[model samples]
Target chain A: MTHAFYVALSYAASGIVVAVLVGWTLLDGRAQQRALKELEAAGIRRRSAARDQAEKKA
Target chain B: MSEPIPAIKKFSDLANPTIFLGLTARIVPFLAVATALMFAFGLYLAFTTEGDYQQGETVRIMYVHVPAAWLSMMCYSIMAASALGTLVWRHPLADVSAKAAAPLGAGFTFLALVTGSLWGKPMWGTWWEWDARLTSVFVLFLMYLGLMALTRALDDPAKSARVAAVLILIGFVNIPIIKFSVEWWNTLHQPASVMRMDGSAIDGEFLRPLLVMAGAFTLLFFTLHFLAIRNEIWRRRVSAQRRLAARMANRES
Candidate 1:
């Protein structure tokens, strides 16, 4: 392969790796957020939030 | 009359997941924007700037290769510190950060190895080399993969975190080996240019773009890291809630 091809491949590989990392991180964040929101809607609260609610009631 | 909001006093307040999640939510968007802008300007400098008379157009690969290599070791170092936090302090976010960093560190190491190989083929006349620097980095890469696998192998996330933290600290010995391999031994890989005892060997023309690319890559790491940590935190929350739900169902039954 030509030098240019090698250079291009390097950049392309780096780009693809970076894109995948960013996509996975963002999508995973969104999915986790959705799952937590679903749980909250089901009347399940995070321990801290549950504590705050208990304090408010008392 | 209403009382004022309480001020956060302890440094451990920063370790609170809710506080961390809130802070990351506020900080990540700006970091993402900065990364985008840096990549744009850095690429412009990379392509438009004059090529190395020695390496010619092939020198362009260094912009990405060096930064990825830098981050590979940097991520490991960060993981090592986080590992200490996990064991010594038992800070909650410490394990979370260490867990989140593994895949990203692996990604950067993979990039570094791939780009280094590609660059080597043209310059060194071979794609594969068993030189000290190359071999040590490959070891570091394997260590990263091992840590990731260990983190996922167990059913209990807490158990996995402790196991992986110990592994990360053990694996950190490779990082310094990777750094000094070129100087400590005769290797095909070039010695440090940007970082050195005397000073950087690179010319200003190349250094400018290289610094920009490095900054861009660092920002990208942080942006992805914070996002991943947030996801891990959310995952834990869901798991906790599920266990709670299961307990409630058991009691009702």
Candidate 2:
């Protein structure tokens, strides 16, 4: 029950919590960003196809 | 063709999701690096330092415990401000930031409590107490939980944001109480060391690391907050696109 032990434990615990949170946020952001990119690309492709069809008719 | 000034101005506005995301993405790296560097330096200093004349090694707990407590309060304050902005201006980003910050603030509050208890066990000879500071912090934790629950309970984003914002504003009353608990009432928790009528009770050797760790935690919170908001925005965008696709499919059918 020395002071050093308590101090060390507190620092370690805080560090671990922060690290895990950061890691989780990064991973979640990457996944969501990728999904959004895919959706945006798909929307653009659909628009281009509709434009091509209209031009062909003209 | 050259873009018009008005168009560029509009594009730079916070109302634009793409612009917000782009700005947040660019800042995230610097915040992350600063957080990491500060934490490393703080930990090194905290470990290398000697025990206090009175408190011995347990004094080291002050470095981590105090900074976490500071962050817990700081995060709650930010949440309250964002909540206010959401309610008044109906800022989409403000709501998202407030919602994303709740769990993180709660996590910091939890750390403050747990580490406080651990530090207490060694010094105060008990793990639990009903002192004013401790009780107020416990109440803060409950408020964080309540705000989080309110955020999730409503299905509509606008409704959720409004309700949660109100709850956060009301809960903010506890923050000042938690801060002044040590002075306003007799509490088992010690009085303020950093903020005092005279000066800081701590010496320079310990104060440096504590300040560094506090800075680090602040940076860390900001970095995580930016990333979380980014994820939330993306999630909403994808959902909106899916809804639009479903509607178009139904029309074609």
Candidate 3:
């Protein structure tokens, strides 16, 4: 491969890796958020949510 | 009687997973915006910088390669510190942070290895080398994968966290080896330029963009780490709810 091709490949590889990392985290975070919301809607309270409510009432 | 804990230590309460998630939720968006801006400015500078006398256009690869290599080691150090918090301090967010970070660390390490090899093929005329630097970095990548797998292997969350924390601490020893390998041995890999004990050898033209890119990458790591930890915290909540339901069902039966 040409020197330019090697350089392009290196940059491209880094770009793809970073894109995949960011994409996966965002998608996973959205899915978990959805699940947490559903559970809360069904009356299950996460410990943090419980604490926040208690502090508010106090 | 023991002296009362200092006020600064009181701030450690932020390590509570719930508080951490709330704080990170507020911070991630701002961090993401800053990282994106930095990347744009850094790339503009990188492309405009005058080409190296020796490496020509190929020198452009350094902007990405150096940051990935730097982050690979940095992510591991973050994990090592988080491991200490998990094992010694029992900080709720510590295990979550370490677990969330392992995948990102592996991705960075993989980028470092692939880009290093790509750059190496052009400069060193070979793609693979058993040199100490390369080998140590590869081992670090394996350690990342191993920790990820070990954390998932056990059904018990508590057991898994402790095991993974121990593994991360053990793997910390290899970091300095990776950092010093180029200098300690005759290797095809270049030694420190920006991080040299003496002043950095890199020219100002190149160093400015490099530092900007490094800052962008660091911010990107934090943004992703925070999101991943938030997901992990939600996942634990779901698991806890399921266990609670099961216990209630058994009691009713």
Candidate 4:
């Protein structure tokens, strides 16, 4: 094989690894946010948020 | 009257996950765009530059390899700082930062190894070697793995953070070893070229692409770190909210 192949392989491998990292972070973040949104929709709220709301009302 | 709102006045206030998440929301998009632009420019430079006098087309590998290797170590250093935050200030987000960095660090280290191997095969006529530089880097990859395993093994997040922090700091010793390994011992891997006390040994042509690539990769790392840290914060919030819901249900019953 030509030396170009080696260079291309290196770039390709790095690109794949980076894509996977980006994909995993985005997917995981989406899932976590979805779960949090679902819980909040169900009337489960953080104490801090509740307090902030009360303070704003007062 | 209700109390006045407290504005974010200092860096320490970022330790608050809610504020950090807000910051992440604001900053990550810019980082992502800058990283993408830099990568585009850097790739253009990498491909356009004339091949090295001796190495020919294979010289292109250095653009990616050097940056990956630099980030592998730089990521660990960032983790070390986060470890300190976990130990000294007990910053809530410190372990989250450190934990998020582990997989990314491992990924860069893995890239460095594989890319270096790719470069080596054409230049050195071998795919593997057992020299100082390579071995120390291999050890660094393992360290990242070990820290990640610690993060997963302990179910208690706080305890896991402390444990991982301690291990991260302990493993910090190997970083300098990896740096000086080539200079200190005989190795197939070349010693520092672009980074040196005297000055960079690289020519102007190669240096341009390499620096741009390094800057691009560094930005990308931070971009990913922020994304990962945001995810971890959300993960914690989800668990906390779930527990709160469970307690509320029990009280209702």
Best candidate according to TM-score = 4
State interface RMSD in Å for all models. 0.8, 2.4, 1.2, 0.6
Full-model lDDT, candidate 2: 0.81
- Pairs that clash in candidate 4: none
What is the per-residue lDDT of model 2 for residues B92-167, given as tens digits with 9 covering 90 to 100?
7888888888878888888899899989998889998998999999999888888888887876678888888888
Tell me what TM-score chain B of candidate 4 gets against the true chain B.
0.96
Residues A1-58, candidate 4: write the lDDT tens digits.
8999999999999899999999999999999988988998999988988998898899
Report the number of the highest-DockQ candidate.
Answer: 4
TM-score of each: 0.95, 0.88, 0.92, 0.97
Could you give the CAPRI-style class of model 2?
medium
DockQ sort, best first: 4, 1, 3, 2
Candidate 4 chain B weakest lDDT stretch, 10 residues: B1-10
Measured with C-alpha atoms, the lDDT of residue B90 in candidate 1 is 93
State the DockQ of every prediction.
0.88, 0.49, 0.75, 0.93
lDDT of 1 by residue, A1-58 (tens): 7778987898899899999999999899888888888888888876767787789999
Looking at candidate 1, what is the lDDT of residue B57?
A: 86
TM-score ranking from best to worst? 4, 1, 3, 2
Instruction: Encode model 3's per-residue lDDT on B137-228: one tens digit a residue.
Output: 99999999999898878867788888899989999999999999998999999989898879999999889999999999999999999889
Runs of candidate 4 exceeding 4 Å displacement: B1-6
Tell me the deviation in Å of residue A43 in model 3. Answer: 3.4
- Per candidate, the number of residue pairs that clash is 0, 2, 0, 0
lDDT of 2 at A6: 76
